[model samples]
Structures are given as C-alpha cells and as structure tokens.
Target: MKTFTKKLTFYMGKGHIVRDITADIQAVVNESKIKEGQVTVQAGRSVCIISTIEYEPGCLSDLEKALEKIAPRNDYYEHSKRWNDENGHAHIRSTIVGPSQTFVIMNGKLCLEPWQQIIFGDYCPNEHPEWEVFVCVIGE
Candidate 1:
C-alpha cells in the first residue's frame, strides 16, 4: 500500500463558495501512483465542509439558501456568547454537514457521476481571510 499527504492553503472570497478540487486531488493520486483507492478532502477549520454536487449558479444559490434554512444566521446561538462569534450557526451547520469527504478513485480517475463535482462547501467560513484544506490519498 502507498500513502500520500498534501495540504493546501486558500483565502476566503466572501459569501458561500464551492471551489472545485477534482484536478488538484487527481494530481495527488497520480503522484502516489494509486490506481485504486480513495481520496479524502478535509477542511481544517471549525466551520467548513465538503460535498459532491452539481456546480451551477442556481444550484449554488440553492445551496446557500439551504444552509441558511439548516442553520439560520440570525438564530440565537449560545456558542456566540462563549466565543463571541456571530457565526455560531456556521459552526453548527458545518458540524451537521461534516468537515471531510472521501471519493473513490478508480482507474486513476475520480469515480463520480457526470454532473457530480467535488465541491468545498464554504458557508460563512468563506468570509474569513485564511483557510486550510487537506488532501490525503491511500492506494496501491
């Protein structure tokens, strides 16, 4: 078995953002020469997540809307008092969604549907100035 690890740094760009990581991850798998296994995308933060979904304008809008519904920003969050962060809902939302996603890599390519894309789902966390991402590959 072979294993590889890579960390990427990024700057948040306001609002909800879904950045594609398919190509970057593919490069990692290629470097490891892993013909079959899995790639996990992990967000190194308390308020970020990963998901596989279609990337489109309306869909992006819907995603932002959905997060709002799942964890409304205006809602009262006791955590805010503890940390004094207005984005307590963001942390809750990311917790519920998750911080990492694993994708199966087959025949040296990501095994994903046609419309499915690896997206770094950034809610309020995207508004921050700094962010970190983890990419780990383990395969033959």
Candidate 2:
C-alpha cells in the first residue's frame, strides 16, 4: 500500500463562497501514482466544508440559499454570545455541510459522475487569508 498527502491553500474573499477543487484532488492522485485507492479531502478549518456538487452558478447559488435558510446569518446564536463574534452561522453551516469527503480512485482517476465535482466551501463572514485543505490518498 502507498499513501500520499498534500496540503492545498487558498485565500478566500469575505462572505460565503464555494470553489471547485476537483482538479486539485485529481492532481494529488496523479502525483501519488496509485491506480486503485481512496482519496480523502478535508478542510483544515471548522468554518469550512468539503463536498461534491455540480460546479455551476445555479447550483452554487441554490446551495448558498439553502444554507442561509438552514442557518440564517442574522439569527441569534449562543456561539456568538460566547465568542463575541458574528460567525455563528458560519460554524453552523460548516457543521451541517461537513469538513471532508472521500472518493474512490479507479485506474488512476477519480470515480465521480459527469456533473459531480469536489468543492470547498468557505462560510466565514470575514475574509480568510489562508484556508487549508488536506488531501490524503491511500491504497495501491
């Protein structure tokens, strides 16, 4: 068995935003040279999420809207009261969306549907200079 690990960093703008990271995960898999394996992509921060989705404007907008409805930014949260910060909604969204995703690698390629793409979601209310993603590939 072989294992390959890589860390990806991104500077994200303020507000909730989603960015396609399928290519990055594939790049790591290619670099690992493992034909059959599993790749796990994890967000380094609790306020972020990693998942697969259709990388399109409509889907992106809908995702944001859904999250907003689930965890409204203007709603009062006990986290904000304890931390004295305005990112309570961010934490809630991240927790609901999760922080990592695992995908199968077959014949040195990611096993995903045509419309499925890995995405990184930053739900922080403020600009984040460095958001980190850790990719780990294991198998032969």
Candidate 3:
C-alpha cells in the first residue's frame, strides 16, 4: 500500500465560507494512481470542518442557518471567557460537524453520488489569513 498527501491553502473571509473541493481531491487521487482505496480530507484548524454535501447555494445556505441555530454566535460560551475569543461558537460548530471526511476511491476516481461533493468549511468568526487543508490518499 502507498500513501500520497497534498495540501491546499485558502484565505477565508469572516463569517461562513463553504467551498466545493471534490475535483481537487479527485486530482490528488489521480496523481496518487490509487485505483482502489480511500481518500481522507482533513481541516487544519479547530474552527473548520470537512464534509460531503449537495453543493448547491440553497443547501449551503440552509446548512449555515441550521448551524447558526444550533450554535448561536451571540450565545455566551465559557470557552470564550477563558480564551477571550469571540469564536466560541465556531469551535462548537466544528465539533458538531467534524474536522475530516473520508471517501472511497474506485477505478481511480472518487465514488460519490451525482449531487454529493466534498466541502471545506471555514467557520471562524473573523477572517483567516490562511486556511490549510490536507488530503491523504492511500491505495495501490
């Protein structure tokens, strides 16, 4: 078995930013020549999440709304008091969503539904000068 890794960096603005990264990941799998195995994509920060979803504006907006309700930004968080950071909700949101996602690679391609796509979400309340994403592909 062999493992291949790639990193992507993005500068994110304040608020939520969801970007579809399916094609990028597929390129990594292709570069690895991993005909069959798995690809794990991970976020490099506590305030970010990696997941798969229907990459549509409506769905993305709904997700952001749901997250806002689940972890309201205005709510008081003990973590905020400790760290004196305003992004306590960002941490909670990331925890609920997760920091990584794995997809099966078949026939040297990502096996995903027609509408399903991998997404990298930056949930930080403030702008992130640099957001790093890691993609790891393992197979033969």
Off by over 4 Å in 1: 125-127
**Candidates, ranked, TM-score:** 2, 3, 1
Candidate 1 vs candidate 3: the lDDT winner is: 3
TM-score of 1: 0.91
**TM-score per candidate:** 0.91, 0.97, 0.95
Query: What would the per-residue lDDT of candidate 1 be over residues 30-63, giving only the tens digit for each residue?
Result: 8878889998889988678888778778787888
C-alpha lDDT of all candidate models, in order: 0.81, 0.92, 0.91
Rank order (by lDDT, best first): 2, 3, 1
lDDT for 100 (candidate 2) = 93
Prediction 1 global C-alpha lDDT = 0.81
> Candidate 2: how large is its RMSD?
0.8
Model 2 steric clash total: 0
lDDT against true structure, model 2: 0.92
Write the number of the candidate with greater lDDT, choosing between 1 and 2: 2
As a whole number from 0 to 100, the lDDT of residue 125 in candidate 2 is 87
Candidate 3 matches the true fold with a TM-score of 0.95
Weakest lDDT window of 10 consecutive positions for candidate 2: 9-18
Q: Provide the lDDT at 76 for model 1.
A: 88
